[model samples]
Target: MIQLHSGSVMLQGGVPAPIPAAGSGRDKTMAYQILRRHHRGPWEGQLHLTFDSLISHDITYVGIIQTAKASGLREFPVPYVLTNCHNSLCAVGGTINEDDHAFGLSAAVKYGGNYVPANQAVIHQYAREMMAGCGRMILGSDSHTRYGALGTMGVGEGGPEIVKQLLRNTYDIAAPQVVLVWLTGTPPHGVGPHDVAIALCGAVYGNGFAKNKILEFAGPGVAHLPMDYRIGIDVMTTETACLSSIWQTDDAVAEYLTIHGRPEAYTRLAPEEGACYDAMISIDLSRLEPMAALPFHPSEAVTLRELLHDPGDYLRQVEQRAAEQFGGKATLSLTDQVVDGKLVVQQGIIAGCAGGMYDNIAEAAAILSGGDVGCGPFSLSVYPPSIPVNLELMQNGVQQALLEAGVLFKPCFCGPCFGAGDVPANNALSVRHTTRNFPSREGSKPGDGQLSGVLLMDARSIAATARNHGVVTSAAEVDYPAPAPVRRTFDGGVYGRRVYFGYGKARPEAPLHYGPNIAEWPAIPPLGEELLLQVASVLRDPVTTTDELIPSGETSSYRSNPLKLASFALSRRDPDYVPRARATQALEEARRSGAIPPELQSVQKALSIPDMGRVQIGSVLFANKPGDGSAREQAASCQRVLGGCANLCYEFATKRYRSNCVNWGMLPFTLAEGTDFPGCPGDFLYVPQVREKVTRGDEEFPALLLTDSGIHALTLYLKNTTAEERELLLTGCLMNHYAAQNAAENRR
Candidate 1:
């Protein structure tokens, strides 16, 4: 169903030609065209981008605004929309969530930004409705900020990137390779966008086929899918580790923008006739089947038919992987879920930006029209993406139909997508239509001996499985009449009633309210002349996600407080990481106060540095590959707060994570391939004159790995850093850099 080509290919006559290009200049793909228009730097090998708009959610907006405020931000320079969806529940933090919402509202007024109230809409859905436009670029603080289906190039990154835009700084990066996603053949009924997305992820994610590249969707298959269908597929592009995504716009896209009350935002976007791509992913949509990604990752996927054929074998593999991931801390028994050669799931959920679209919910309601989710442990719940979608569902009677069929209808919230709501019982299996199925992402605390598993599927299959009384079933096998298409009528009144439209209207005198849980960032020192880093944690996992770095769900409530949130860093993956990091931090604190802890006295003597005052002590984490999942800056900020000064990895999983590290002033160091890192936890690695080398634009640095036996020499590389990034690192962090600049301006 999918074919991957790893060579330069030209688009001639709307088809990819597998011959090498004979040209000298860069072949401008659709992504390049959109980026070029937004590029502030001179047209060259690199791009310095200034997006048309920016966005963030409640979990992120509070910290982003706080950092900007500390950096002397007067008002938003562009349209900034802060949506309250992640922490909308107000159940975990005891008035803190709502306080953050109020702060968001006040910030919107005080800074001339837009604010979408709690339950009004999720961040991406709101952006799709109001922010996305053809040939426009958007930068967001969420990883799934993909509006490519609407012809908008949405790049999701850490909050610091958005902060740069707020301060009129540019997002700098080397020119990215573009991948052509040539789609052909129309999908059959019962095959949803999630199905195609899962297959694509399975094909590309593991091998890094499109990592840090742009995916340009083109060809005949693009015309067959509806706007929402395209969106469902496009949002999952984040799972493929791509930088951004864009689709060729047609009348369907234009109609989607027009129906959302933004007719002028519509424009045709397609690659030029002879555009070239660094790689090509050809997908035959008609050949796609009902699929599910098992626990641990979205890439660990297989067709439902293939899974059912060998249930025991496939499930045993999942069990073994769970064991390896959790280190036998918890038990995950997927094989036990198979009863008499049939798989049974305990829960079904269709929620969030990926699954909660109007058509997805409408189709699910159609499948469950008269049939009831049988009384057992099995239950079904549906969440609409936005208030407008909910109103349309009600108007079309899909809501009533679902309610009559004993399916629970929830408000517009992103809880289900990230383990905030609808968590299953211990050892139970949940089939969801959400964006991810990563381990412990469904709110299970594996370290505490409580564990559950999630399998990702489309809403139609979940509905069909619910109709089967929890037995695994495919939607294609079910005989049901297709519901008549519902003409969506967007209700702008819903948003106007609840949302605070404060853009272009700054109330500088507005008093900002702060919850007691909200706190200022702790002071971080700038990079010193010499650095001594103790290895706090070493993870050999092929890929480590951001969820494992700082965790999501309940822990997100403390994002506003750096110290409190830092305590949960790597709590799931490494239960002892925080304590070790804290200990390292205490040693550094003591060193700053003119005292060296006895633990590092041996190291001080070994390095022949009698005066420890000249060197800085911090923590370092080693991983094969890290930063795979969320674009949340807390993943790096929490490490920074815990005295983490460097990350040693074979390679970074995504550009956003690396950017987060740079923005946090962490040394994103990478060793050469096949180079052995002969250091473990409690060992020290020292680099001399690091600050001077970084500022001098030096990429290679000789470092010493100090073990108990002896000292070993190793080489580390810091590649592709821009001039401003180096300054941020040398100045401690982006906030510190900006604060110093502001102070200097005040003196001038």
Candidate 2:
């Protein structure tokens, strides 16, 4: 169903042609054109871009704004939207979630930004309705911030990038390669967008086919799918580890913008004739099947037919993988869910930006109409993307149809996708149409001996399985009449009633609201002359995600308070990480107070560095490859809060995570691929004149590893750091760098 070509190819007469050389300066793909327009700085080798707009949800907006405030932010430079979706449920912490909502409104008023209240709309949906436009670029704090299907180039990065945008700084990066995703043929009856997405992810994720590249969607299939269908597939591109995505716009895209009351935002966007691409991916949509991603990752996917035919083998493989992930702390057995040679699931969910679009929900309602979800442990729930979609569902009678079929409806919250809501019973299996099925994403505590399995499927199959009393049936095996296409009505009144649109109307005199739980950031120290790091944790996973670095469920309530949130860092994956990091922090405090701890006596003797006053002591973490998932800055900031100064890895999984590390003053260090780690948890690594080396743009640093087995020579690398990023690391953090600049200007 998919083919990848590594050689350069040119689009001539709407067909691909083999090119002898890679793309040249004259070759302008659609991504190149859009990026050129957005590029503000010199674009010779790299790009320093400033986006047209910025967005953040509640879980991220609070910290982003706080950083900007500390850097002397007066008003928002561009349009900014703050949506309350991730923490909208307000059931976790006592009054903290609501307090965040109120704080968002107050910040919007004082800083001239927009704020969407809880249940009004999810972050991406709100952007789709009001913010996305052709030829424009947007930056968001959430990883799945893709509006490419709507003719916009949306880039998701950590909050530091958004803070830079808020402060009118540029997003600097090496120009990425553009990959053409050529699609043709219409999808089969049973195939949904998620099925196509799962297939694409499985093809590219493991081999890094599209890593850090722009995916430009073009070809005959763009004209065949509806706007919502294209969006459903586009949002899942984040799983492929790509930088961003965009699609060629046609009449269907124009009509979508017109229906949403923004006709002027629509524009034809297509690659010029003879445009060259660095790589190409060809997909045949008709060959796709209803797919499911088994537990542990979204890339571990297989067709439903393939899974049901041999359920035992697949179940056992998943169980073995879970054992390796959790180290046998909890048991995960999908084998028990099989009965009479048929697979069964205990729960079903259709929610979030990827699965909760209007077309998916409407089609699912039609599939489940007049069919009852049997009253067992199995249950089904649906959440619309926005209040506008909810209103349309009610107007078209889809809501009543689903309600009559024993399907519960929830608000527009992101909890279901990220483990804050809809937790299953111990060891129960859930079939969901959400974004991710990573371990612990369903909110179960494996360290406490509780585990649950989640299989990712499309809404159609989830509805079909619900209709069959949760027998894990496919939509192709069921007979249901297709729903009539209903004209969607854009209800701007919903947002007018709940959302606060304060852009261009800043009230500088407005008082800021502060809740008891909301606290300022802890002080971060600047880089020292010499560095001494103790390895705190070592992970050998093939790819470590941000979810493992810092979990996303109830702990998100303490995001505004850095120290409190840091306490939960790696709580799920490494139960002893926080305490170990804290102990290292105590030792650092003693060193700063002119007293060396007894723990460092052996290290001082080993390195013969008797003067401990010149060396700064902190902790480090080593992983095979880290930062695969979310764009939350807390993944790196939490480590920094607990005296972490460096990360040792084979390579970083995504650019956003590495940016987060640099912006938070952490040394993003990497060792050679086959090199063995020289230090252990209690060992120390000493790097002389580390601050001077980084300031001088040095990539390689020779260091000494002090261990119980004596000292050894180790070499670390810091690659691809921009001048501003290096200064950010040397000056403590992005906020500190900007604060120092403001202070110098004040003195001038």
Candidate 3:
């Protein structure tokens, strides 16, 4: 269904053709055109960009605003939207979730920002309806912040990046390569956008064909997709590990903006002739089949027909993979879900940004028009992306039809996508149309000896599975008439009536409301001359996601409080991580108090360090490739809160994760290619004159790996760090750097 071309390509006569050169035509691409408009610094090789707008949900906004406040933020420099979708549940922590909602509202009022109330709209949906504009760039604190289908380029990063935007600072990065996702042919009847997206992710994610590249969608197939169909596919681009995505805009896009009462936001955006792309992905949409991603990752894609053909084998693979992931802490039995040679799932969910769009829901309603989900353990639930979308479904009779078909309709929330709602029973399987099916997404604590699994499918296939009482049937096997396209109505009144719009009306005298659960960040010391790091956790997994570094479910409720949240760091993957890190932190505390602990005295004696005051003791984590999922800053911040000073990995799965580590003042260290990291917990890594090397912009560092066996030579790399990043490391973190700048300005 998808083909990847590694070499350069160019737009020749409105089609991708192999190009001999790759440099000059890059400026002609739609992505670079938008980048050129937003770029603030000199375009030597790196890009320093300032976005038109910024967005965050409750789980992230509190910490972002807090960081900005500590850095002497007076007012928001750009339009900021705060939505309470992820922490809207209020069931996990008593009064804490609601307190965060109150805090979000108060912050919006105090800082001249916009606030969308709980259950009103999810983050991306509100952005699509209100914030997206042609040629505009938006930065968000959520990883799935993609608006490319709307002719807007949306980039998702950690909260610190949003704080930078709030402080009027630029987002710094090397100019990323652009990949052309040239689509051809229309999709088949049963194939939905998720099918095409899953196929694309499976083809490119593993091979890194689209990694950190802006995917520019063009070609003949773009004309066939409706606005919502295009949006559904676009949001899933995050799974492919691409930096961002943009598409050629047409009348359909204009009509979407017009219907949303922002006709001025529409602008025809297309690549110029001879636009160069570093690589190209050719997707034949017509060849796509209804697909499902097995447990653990979106890249583990398989055709539903193939899965049903040999259900036992595929389910066994999932079981084995789960065993490897949990390492006997918990057991997942998907093979038991097979009955009579057919796979059976207990629950089905069509929710969140990818699956909650109008087109996916209306078609799912059509598929189940005359059918009903049987009265079995199996159940189906649907969450509309926004109240406006839910209103359209009600007006179109889609909601009522699905309601009568035994499909439960839920309010707008992102809980299902991140494991806060409709959690499956232990050992049960759930088929979902959400953005991810990662291990932690199942909402079960494997450390507690409880585990469940999720399989990602398109909404159409999920509806078909619901109709068959969760027999894991593909939509292609069921003959259903397509739903007639209805006129989309965006009721701006829903937002106007409830959402707090305070942009450009800063109330500087207003007080920020703080609850008991809310707390300030602790003081962080600056980098020392010498660094002593103890390996706290060693992960051999091919890729370690942010969810495993810091889990999502109940722990997310404590994101506003760093220490409480840090307690749950690596709780799911390694329950001993927090205690080990805390023990190391105690040693650091002793070092800060002008005394070296007996544990580190041996290292000081071996290294012949005369002055213990020049050394800093902290913890380190080693993984093959870490930071694969989520843009939550807590992944790195939680580690920092528990005295983590560095991360040793072969490579980072995404740029956002590496940025998070640097912004939080953790040394983002990488091993050379094919280098084996045999270090484990209790091992020591001693680096001399670390502060001088980081300030000098040195790329390589010689270190001693002090294992019980003896000292061994090791080399670590700190590559591609900008000057500002170096300052952040020297000052301890972004907050410290900003505070120092403000103090210097005061002195001046």
lDDT of candidate 1 over 1-748, digit per residue (tens) = 9999898888878788886852422355788889888888577778999999999998899899999998888899999999988998898989888888888888999999998999989889999998999999999999999999999999999999999999998999998888899999998879899999999999999999999999999999999998889999999999999999999999998888888899999989888878888889999999999999988788888999998888889889988888888888999888899999999999999998999998888888888877989988899999889989888888889999988888898878988888789989999999999999887788888888888999999998999999888998889888877779767678888887878888799999987889888899999889988899999999988889999998888988888888998999998889899999989999998888877778779888887665677788999999999999999999999999999999999899999999999999999999998998888899999998898899899999899999977999999999988888899999999999999999899999
User: For model 1, which pairs clash?
Assistant: none
Whole-model lDDT, model 2: 0.90
As a whole number from 0 to 100, the lDDT of residue 649 in candidate 1 is: 94
- Candidate 2: minimum summed lDDT over ten consecutive residues — where? 21-30
Model 3 agreement with the true structure over 1-748: per-residue lDDT tens digits: 8888999998888878997778889999999999999999678879999999999999999999999999999988899999989998897899999999899888888889999999999999999999999999999999999999999999999999999999999999999999999999999988999998888889999888888999999999999999989999999999999999999999999999999999999999999998999999999998889999988899999999899999899988888988888899889988899998889999999999999999999989888989999999999999999999999999999999999999999989999999899989999999999999998776888988889999999999999999998899888888999998677899999999999999999898898888888988888778889898999999999999999999998788998999999999999999999999999999888988877777788888876667888888899999999999899999999999888999999999999999999999999999998987778798889888899999999999999888877788889999989899999999999999999999999999
Against the reference, the lDDT scores of all candidates come to: 0.90, 0.90, 0.92
Q: In angstroms, what RMSD does candidate 2 have relative to the true structure?
A: 1.1
Instruction: List the candidate 2 regions with Cα displacement exceeding 4 Å.
Output: 25-27
Q: How many angstroms is residue 56 displaced in model 2 relative to the true structure, after the best TM-score fit?
A: 0.5
Candidate 1: list runs displaced more than 4 Å.
Answer: 22-28
Give lDDT: candidate 3, residue 416. 91
